[model samples]
Structures are given as structure tokens and as C-alpha cells.
Target: CFYLLFNSVLFSVLSDVELRSYRWLQTMIFTVEEINRNPVLLPNLTLGYLATDTCLSEGSTLSAALSIVTGQDKAVTEQCTKAPNVSLFPFFFCAPHLQVSYFASCACLSDRTRYPTFLRTVPSDAFQAQAMARLLRQMGWSWVGVIYGDDAYGKSGVQLLIQELEGSGVCVDYTEVIPKSHALEKIKRIVERIQSSKAQVVVTFAISPDIEVLLKEVVRQNATDRQWIATEAWSTSTHYSAWSGISLVGTLGFALRRVDIQGLGSYLTQLSPEEHTNEQLVQNVWEEVFGCKFGKEMYSGPHCTGLEKVEVQGEAYFDVMYNVYKAVYAIANAIQDIFFFLPTYIKYGQSKKLISGVKFTTPVGELVHFDNNGDPSASYDIINWHMGAEGKVEFVKVGQFDAARGPQQDFQLDLINMENRLYIIQVPVSVCSESCPPGTRKAVQKGKPVCCYDCIPCATGEISNANSRECTKCLERFWSNTDRTECIPMLVEFLSFQDIMGIILSVLSIAGATLTGTVLTAFFYHRDTPLVRGNNSELSFLLLLSLKLCFLCALAFIGRPAPWSCMLRHSLFGISFVVCLACVLSKTVVVLVAFRETLPGSNIMRYFGPAQQRAGIFVCTLVQVLICVLWLVLAPPLPTESAGGELGARVVLLCAVGSVIGFSLVLGYIGLLAAICFLLAFFARKLPDNFNEAKFITFSMLIFCAVWIAFVPAYVSSPGKYTVAVEVFAILASSYGLLLCIFAPKCYIILLKPEKNTKKSMMAK
Candidate 1:
């Protein structure tokens, strides 16, 4: 059996050795020899290989593939009964022959209808594109520029990348294609686009040679501040590593996972020109590594000593060499299966089928097999380029990607101390716009991608998180905090005794009650005096007592409203005012009846005597008591929270009148008694008597009626705690008016003018 190896040998006309490609060629030869020496694998079968140089040209690659199939160019190809071709080139014209490649990673090659016999040891570019899209999203790089080569590999890879970025909030601002001819002016124009782009991150989907030309211009123009994302094609290329000083210091890319093959390193270091004199590629590599000439006649340089050795400098030389080794072993395993288990006389088409089903574990313990698409299991190592000793580039493994894991668990990054190696102190920011913080939401621009947007603050009663698309309104009883990031409970307000307004109203209420007590004491002390007897001291004492009760009832309105307080405050105010008004009405009747009885044998005093006056007061007060009972039983007031009107940020704790009609009737009854008392006192104000008590009763009733009439509008218009304050003020004002108007003149006569309190002053008018 024979293995045909074809690879790009020449990169330019100057014939400089591409060390990385040369290492891949040597890896294939070493694997073929290792398999032949194994005892149990293929006992007596020996494998031979034919190496061909394509000179990195498409025409040359096609010609070399044809020569291997026809067995016309090499003696080894003619002697072999069966040969499997292994190609390192990406693009090829598919034929019926079995072609297994170590480097062809174009996504189009995975189509079984287009290339029926094509298979590869490396993963397709489809998976690499997905990985690239995920990396950009993970890093929050929403805006970026893409540059691809003009070949099938570059075009298909970038097309798949853009498709994977759909709906991910990652946009490609511009895409430039590298020319096939490597023209200087065309490459310069592409560089100009890179420099002018607003995106700080640039991604490339081209092979090493195409990228090398473009980067040369990039370094010449000194455009080195961008963060570069590389594909597997040229991530570890030594060609760029030599020239990548600070220009590509913190470059990030994906590469095939590296595995250490035992004895592979020692075999690579043992290469010399004397041992491989028959191979021209080996002699050329020897001259390049040792800086000497194999033949002094060909070039005027020092001749190689034939003992010069090659030291593997970096893993860049062996990164893709493992792929070449796996391809050779896979073909040998397929042949072993064919001879031992299958029929000896197999067709050429059957050989391709046999290789497709081959599965084996490598020496490094990695399972090697191809799937239905003729591609291996997809996996990659995230590589970061760092400046190493003497300014050389080092490939640091910072993360991993596996296709077999879950979507959320597949891509992982471990970038410990990675920021120290970057050109800047922090990870580069590559977004078109900054992210929206808390309390703000993103407003998308009219004609741009979702990533390009403006940030707007949340409304007054709303809140939002970082990068949120919309603001959420707070609940009814809640309000937004100062930063608007969260919702908090609103401030609850009520007429509490701790407040300044509540304290002032409470003190005034106490003072009025105390003054009423003082007046009641003075009347009791002088009960036998003529002035007190003439005014009917029993009615005077009862009126003063009722006024004191009215003053104390206002205290219930100046505290936190509860179910009991809400019901009691209105009931007490209604009943106390009714009793006080009944006393005033009885006194006014007594004044008019006394004047009529003195004129000429009148019977009015006989009807309105002490017993009759007490009955009249009791009947009037009983009517108010029945109204309060019905009001509390049917629909009484209760404490409730109100958040309407200007109380947007707070909740007002106040009493809600359950039935408006019930409350109106209570106030209406008090007004009816006051109207009767006022009209009777007005008629008796001109009575022929000194110390006319009717005059004081008329003024007190007028003041009481006026204060409550003004309170109606103020109570209805007030909000929150002020509504309770207005009601308390009305109660205090009316109580003080009755106390001062009716008794202030009587107290002055009894204390200051003892002579005027005698019987002579009582009968002066």
C-alpha cells in the first residue's frame, strides 16, 4: 500500500522555506514508518509514501493530484497496488478517487452531493464560524469588521459567520475581501477601510499567505490598536509571528486542540541532510534551519556539515503536524480492516467506504473518527498571542470549545492575568455604543442594529435594570427609589399627635376646656348671689359643662385614625354640640317668658318653668342621640388609605365616610337647634331687664353658625392630614365662642363688681 502526500511547498518566488509546512510533511513520513514497524497492526504489510510539492499554486496542485492517480511520475506509485491521497491544500476539484485531507476546512466540502469521496481529518469551517460568533458575543463586541480572502475557504467561512451572528446583537459594520493576486494597491485600500472603521475589533477569515500580505501593510500604516480575531487557518502561523511585535501583541484566535504524540518530537529533532539525501525537500529544510547550503555549487554559502540538527523551536511547528499524522494512521487502519475482515479483492469505491467507517484511538488517547459529513468531532483551543522572551510571540491557551457539550457549557474561558499582556490595562471595548446602566433603558436607533441605541432614563414611577429594553412601573402602593432601580413602600401620612400641626391643635383644645372649667367653678362658688340666680344658674352651669365636653371631643381627631377613632370622633362632635345648643335655646326662652310674666298676669312663665325647661332640653338632645345611633349602625366612617390627587409619592391615612347622608343628618340637627335659639334670642334682646342674657345667646349662636358654615368648604377641599386638621379647628373655634360670649360678662359682674351683683343691679333695667 502507498500514501500520497501533497502540500504547499513554495510561498513566493524567492524560495524561502515555510518551516511550519515543512514540519507537516516530515510528520506524515514518520507516521508511515512507525506503522510499518508495529508487530500486531499490519504484520507483514509495508507502507510506502510519495511526496509531491504543489508550489502553493492551484494549477500545480491539480497536476500533482493527477500524476499520483495515473502512477506516471514516481517509481513508488507504480509499484504500489493501492494508494490513498492525503492533501493539505484547501481547494480541490473533486473526482472519483479517494482523497483524505489534513487541512481542507471549507464548509462547502462537507456537502456529500458535491464531493462524494472527499474526507478530512480536521473540522469544517462551519464549526469554527460558530465559535467565532460566540466569542464575539461573549466579549460584548457588538460591532466589528470582517476581512476574508477571495477563495472558497474564506468566502464560505465568513458567510457562515455572519449567518451565525443573526439576532445575537453582534453586527458586522464592513466586510473586505483579499484579492487572489496579492496586489499592493488593493491591499492598501483594504487597510484604509480597517483604519477608518468605528469598530475596534476586526475579524479575518483568510489563509496564512493572504493574511501575511495584508498584515504587512497594516504594520506599515501603524494601525495596531485593534483587537484581532483569527480563524484556525493562520492562528499559529510562524510567518506572522516573526513580524508580530506590538502590532499583534494581544491577538486572540481559535486553533485545533493540541495533543502530544510520544516519540514524535524526538523523531523531528533527529533530521539531517545525510540521512535524507534522496529527498530534495529535506535538503532544502536543512539549509534553511542551519543557515547553510546543501550543495556549494548551487549557492555560494557554507556547506552543511551533514551532522547539523534541527531543534523544534515552538509548538507552531507541530500544531498542525498532528493532523497529518492522524490522516496516515487512519488509512493504515482501514487497510488492516479490509485485508483481515473484508474481501481481499475490494473495488476502489469500496475503499472510500472502508476508510469512512474506520475508528481508532490515537497514541495520545484521543478517539479519532469521522461523522456522516466526513468531518472529525469539532473542538478547539482558544489562543491568545503574547509577547514572550526576546519579543517572540507566545501562544497561550486561555479557553476551550467543544461541540459535544451543552450550548451553555460548550464555550468556556479561563483568562487568568490575561489583562497584563494586553496593550491596554483593561479588556478592549469594541461596541458601537456603551451599555445602558440601571434606571435607564435602551432605545434603538432608527436605522441601525439593535446594538446601536440610545439610553433613556425611566419615568418617575418606573424602574429598570442594566441593559433593559423597557421600564417596569411600580405597584400601586409602592414608589420608585431615588436611583429608580427598585421600588419601595410609599410614605404613609396621618394626623398624628407627634406632628407640629397636631400638637398645636391639641394644646388649643385643652386650653379652651380649662377656661370653661374655670368659668363653671366661679358660678358654683357664687350660687346664692342674686346675679347668678337671676340668670337661672342651673342652665348656666349645664351650658358651661356642655361647652367643656365639646372642647375635649376635638382631641379624638388629632391622632392616627383607627376604626374606633374614626367612628368616635364624628359621634362625639355631633352629640356634644347638640347638648350645648339645647342649653342656649332654653336660656333664651326663659328670658322672653320672664319679661312677659312681669307685664300683666301672663301664663308663659308657668309653662316654661324649671321642670318644663329641663324636659325641652332632654327632648331636643334625644333627637341627636337617635340620629347618631342610626348613623353608626347603618354606615359609619372607617379609616382608609387614600392615594389620589397630589399624593403620588405618599398614601394618606384618613377616615372614609361610609354614608354621606348619615353624616349630613348629624350636622343638620345641630344647625336646626341653633337657628331656633338664634331667632328667640334676637326677639328678646330688647327685653326690659338689666343683664339681658338673650343678647349674649344671640351672638354666641351667630358665631357658632358662621364657623361651621366656613368649615364645610375647607373640609371638602383639604387633602391628607389637613382634612382632619380643618375639622378640629372648627370644633375648637365654636366651643371658644360660646364659652366667652355667654359667660365673660357674668364672670366680670360677680368677681370685679360685687355691688352690681346685688338685687338693686339685677332690677335696674
Candidate 2:
């Protein structure tokens, strides 16, 4: 019978030795021992447990625990429906008020899936953040900087602090991101940035590594004049000596600990003799069990061994843990006796549910019964780490608060002044002065008070409204009048000579593109020369058509808004420039290939077979199509409303052909092609060959590519009328390349060699 019971037990509580600090393992061990001794309605059975040494370094111990618990299944069914009891219980002893995510992966929180079963002993992390905010507000610190690790812990803490601060009329002066690895170089950079920010109070969501790096850097840089605050990770025995030794002594830290005596007594009464021993107590427990000495053994960071009030201001941390233990027992008791877990409607009628409501009176106050979410009606302790009269490290419970109330009402307590402590520093409160008056800006800081500063009224072209910090500039259609006192419309008078200049330029660009396209077409169809040969002619014609389109589009882009003008501007401006650029690129590649083929032993020439050349043309055209498609997808066609009504409705929806990256790449590709083409043409020109027209084509493309490349900077930087001027320049430059490259030679032969043309014509007649 003894062997059967022993083997049936899944856990064995061999020795229950509670250190001053009840870590996750110790908490579990204590609970198991208490349950075994009391025989909580179990069918004549007891459990044993074996405790081993584990480090608190990261997730090492959690990984070990998960491995040990694998494949061990001893079913302990509470309800008759037969769910495994061990599996049913997901979690136990959580720091409920500690909502910040720093210790999310610790062994204590290894099983998140079992969260419902996992009971939290303390409040959520939000509770701690809210408490800190209230404390800051009470102290009248309006502006603060936060330096947190770049992880879930730091981010969540920052969010809570931000929420708390914003409501209290405080603004975040700076937010610093510190990596978990705590690289000294990275920390040094962050520290330097923080020092330059001129922040008075620094709140840190850092682990020990981050803290050590930050503190060392702060002290080294003499940036220790400001205050330092910490989160829960430093609330254990590990940080006490190191923190005390550091130049930073008066720094405030936030963590969860059980200091309720009523809860502690209830917990002890329920435990077995082994669990109830001196080892199981808070400070007293550690010295007896481990035979290791600590100066003032405290549960959380800020309490001590003696009742000097100088060391520990309040009750021990045993109280908080004890309250948690009582809550668990109450919940378990209700589930067994009254079967209070049974619901009104059930699949199996009249069967008890796994969970039940719990209510308990804790030492702090009334810890009301929990609802389904396991929300406890409890408050949090605000503790401080300070050096005592004995010159030893100690924690003191300075204040406590309830987070359930409204922002203004929550955590209202007198702050314990720790100005004498080493880590804490007194900082002057910052005031967010009222914004400069509507008509002026902060005028040369006339003195200390904000209202004493001077102000300047808005200029004639600008107007200001209430609640606006600065004046608004007027539109381009109107300008300030001569008086410089008020704005008036810009009077327009019909001008005849200005119109003549615009007409002449428009006609010239159109004539050049049209005559060039016509001449190139005639040469391709009628001439026997190889200059007229090759598939490059089709691409040349496309370039010619795109150039003509640009000329027409520019003409359409004149005057105030019109729908027809808007559509033409977007379609022709974006489409024509792209296609023309593509054609120039194709011509450059052709010239490079021709030179390569002429070279003695160049395999590069072989790569550009007819198929490859055709593929190249297809790729270039496809790139232009993709650019248009991107514009269609990203920039919606729907016209945005304007301040000026119907006249402004017609917005020029010119598609930005490429983003900066795309723009740079396209330009680079064209530049590279042009460079190769010109280099080859230069060498080819040295041979005083007949009709060296390829040289003109090569040099023309080099000039064209350089012009387009330079256009990017000019077009991007140009403002107002200058932008229109640049667009017109681009239109002329792109179209003229085709005229110069394809039609110039034919034009020269026709006009310069007139006698040869006439003689050929007479002979044909």
C-alpha cells in the first residue's frame, strides 16, 4: 500500500526550506509540502518533492524545469469528469501588479497557456507604473527622460509611464533605446545622448546588465546630478551589494513583495512542520536553511531585518506572499466543500466546475473575492533602497497606493524625502510655458518669466488665428500689395510681347521633333545605306514620338486648373520622358555592341545576339510600364480637395516615375551605358573612317544622359516658376537627342550636298 501511494504521487516534497526570498521554485515547493501535510481531500495520498540549486540568470532554470517535467504524468483529478489535476493547474504565485514584461520568461511564468490556473500573488505591472507616475506628479517633476532596454519589458514599461505622465501634465523629454546585450560602446553612445538632452529625472526599464553599464557611464561622465529609478529585476538579493557599492545610492526602485502579516500567519498554519520552520520565514528563513549570511534579508528590495524604522519602515515581505497563499487556499476550499464551482447549466448536470470564487482578508486590508479574471482588490507598495545608520544596504517601505481609483485620486500619499541618499538627486521642476502669442515667437528670452517676452505681428502676406502658434502664408495667385499693411489680389493686364516669346519656343520644339521624325522615316524606307539598317530604327521612332508628345503636353500644362490639362500633364509628362529615356539607353547599348564586335577578340560582342538585343528592348519597355503601374497602385487617382474651390480642383497628377532608390538606379544604369558607348566611339573616331556618324550618336547620348542625371537635382530643388522652367528644359533636351542622332546626317546631306541631290534627280527623270 505504501509503495502504491508513493509511486502514484507525481511530486515529492523532500525538504521544504524557505529562503528569505521565496523564488519561483521555493514557492512551488512550499505549496506542495503544505498540500501533502494537510491531505486536501485526496484519497489517502501524499506527495514528495526534490529541490535543487538553480541560477536566476535568464531562462536557464526555466529550460531545465521544462525538461524535468516532460513525460511525467501522474493524474490527480479533482472533478469526476477526469481532467488531470496537474494539467488543470496552469499557474501559481504571479506578481499580478507587475504588468511590465521583464520577467515574462522566468521559470515562474514558464507556462502562459496555463494562465487561468496560474494564480498571481501580486498586482499587474501597470499598477507599478501608475504608482510611479503618481509619485512623480506629487514631487512636481514635469519633464523626464526614459532609458529602457529594447525589448518587451522596456516597451511596456514606457507605455505605462507615458500614459501616467501625460495625464499628470508631464512630457517625455527623451526616449532612449538600450540593447539587452549591454555592449559598452552602445551604452556609451546612449549615455552621451542622455547627458546632452538636459533631462532632470531619468526613469530606466533596465535589467542588471543595462543598469551596471548605464550607471558606470553616468558616473564616469559626471551625469549623476539627476535622479535614477529602476524596475523589478533589481528587487532581489543579487542587486543589494552591488547597488549599495555603486556611486548611485539614492535611486528609487519599484517591485512587488508580500508584507501582510495576516496573510503570512494563515499561510504558516496550513503548512507542514518542515514548511513552517524558521527557514520558511522571510529574513529569518534564509539564514537557517542555506547557512548563508545576508546583511538584512528582505523579500522585496526595500525592507530590512530589524525594527529600527531606519532600516524597514513597514512590515516584512512575508505579508505579500502570505496573502497570495491564503487566496489560493480559499479558492481550493470553496471548490471542495460547497462545490461552489458548479454552474447553473452544465453538460453533466450538477457536476462541479474546476474553478471557484475566493474572498480573503489580508493584512493590508480587505482582499475582495476574485472574478473570473482573477483580479484581486489590492494595493502596491512603493519601496526605496537606502543606506542605514550602520552604513549597510537596506530597503524601506516609504509609501503604498491603490491603483483601482481614477488618475487624480490614485496613490495619493506623502513622499518620503530621501534627499540624503547617495543615488537620489534633487532636481528643479520644469514648467511647460504657454506657447508664444499668436502674432509672435519667443523673442530672445527677455527674462525668466514666459509672459515678459516680446512679440512681432504677422506680415502683410500672412494671417493668424486663435490657438495657432504661427502665421499662415498666402497663396501664389495673390501677393502682398505695396502698402505692406494688408494683402490685395495681384492685378493682371494682358501683355502682347510675353505671349510672343511663349509662342515662338512652343513652335520651335514642335517643328524640331516633327521634321526629325519625318526625315528618319524617309531614310529608313528609301535609303540603301546600312545607317538606315538594324532593328534599332523602331526604338528610334518611339523616342521621336515620345519627344513630340512632351512638346504637346507642355503646351497643355499652361494657365489655371482645367481637367483636360491635368490628364494630359500626368499622362504625357510621365509616359513620354520614360519612353524617351529608354530609347536613349537602347541606342547606347547598340553602339557599345557594334564597337565590341569590331574589336579583335571580344566575346562581349557575342553575348548581344539578335535575341538578346530584342530582349533588352522588351526589358526597357517593361520597366517603363512597371513605373506607370506603381504610380497607379500607390498614388490614388481621386483628386484631393483644395482650399480654393472649382478652379483648384484640377490638380496635375503627374506620376513620380520612381522613388529616390528607383530614380538613382535608373540614372546609374543609363550613366554606365552612356560611359561605355562614348569610350568605344572615342576609340572608333581615331580611325579617320568615312561617315563617322556613330561618333555623333555616341557623344549625343553621353550629353543627353548627363543632362537627365543633372535634371533630378534641379527638378527636385526648383520651386514655383523655376519648376515650370526646368520641365520645359527637360522636354526640349530629350526630344532634340533623337533629332540630332537619327535625322541630322540626312538633313546635312540634303541641304549641304544640294547639287548631288539635283543631279541624281535629273538622271532619274
**Runs of candidate 2 exceeding 4 Å displacement:** 1-118, 207-213, 216-223, 235-238, 241-243, 257-368, 404-408, 416-424, 427-765
lDDT of 1 by residue, 1-765 (tens): 555544545333235667776677668878888888989777888877656555555555677667667866552111112111223364222223556778789888888787666678888989999999999988889999999988787889999999999988898889999887777999999999998988989999987767888988999999988889998877887667776677887889898878777888888788876777786766777777777986578777788887865688655535577888887777777667777755643643365566467788877787899887788988888888887767678888878899879787889877565666654324678888898999999999999888788999988779999988899999988988778899988888888899999999999999999999999999999989999998898999998999999999999998888899989999999999999999999999888877767566557678898999899999988998998889899998999997642426678889887789989999999889989989999999988778888998889889989998999999999888899999999999989989989999999999999889999878875
Quote the lDDT for 312 in model 1.
80
Q: In model 1, where do residues sit more than 4 Å from their true spots?
A: 2-17, 42-99, 106-118, 124-144, 149-193, 196-198, 269-309, 313-317, 337-356, 405-409, 420-426, 434-494, 523-543, 578-636, 639-723, 741-765
The residue pairs that clash in candidate 1, if any, are none
| Candidate 2 lDDT over residue span 356-423, tens digit each | 24454432464545444444444665556666666555666666676666655656443535554433
Looking at candidate 1, the ten consecutive residues that score lowest on lDDT are 75-84
**The candidate that achieves the highest lDDT relative to the unseen native structure:** 1
The top-ranked prediction according to TM-score is 1
Q: Write down the TM-score for model 1.
A: 0.78
Residue-level lDDT for 10 in candidate 2? 15
Clashes within 3 Å, all models in order: 0, 32
Q: What is the C-alpha lDDT of each candidate?
A: 0.81, 0.49
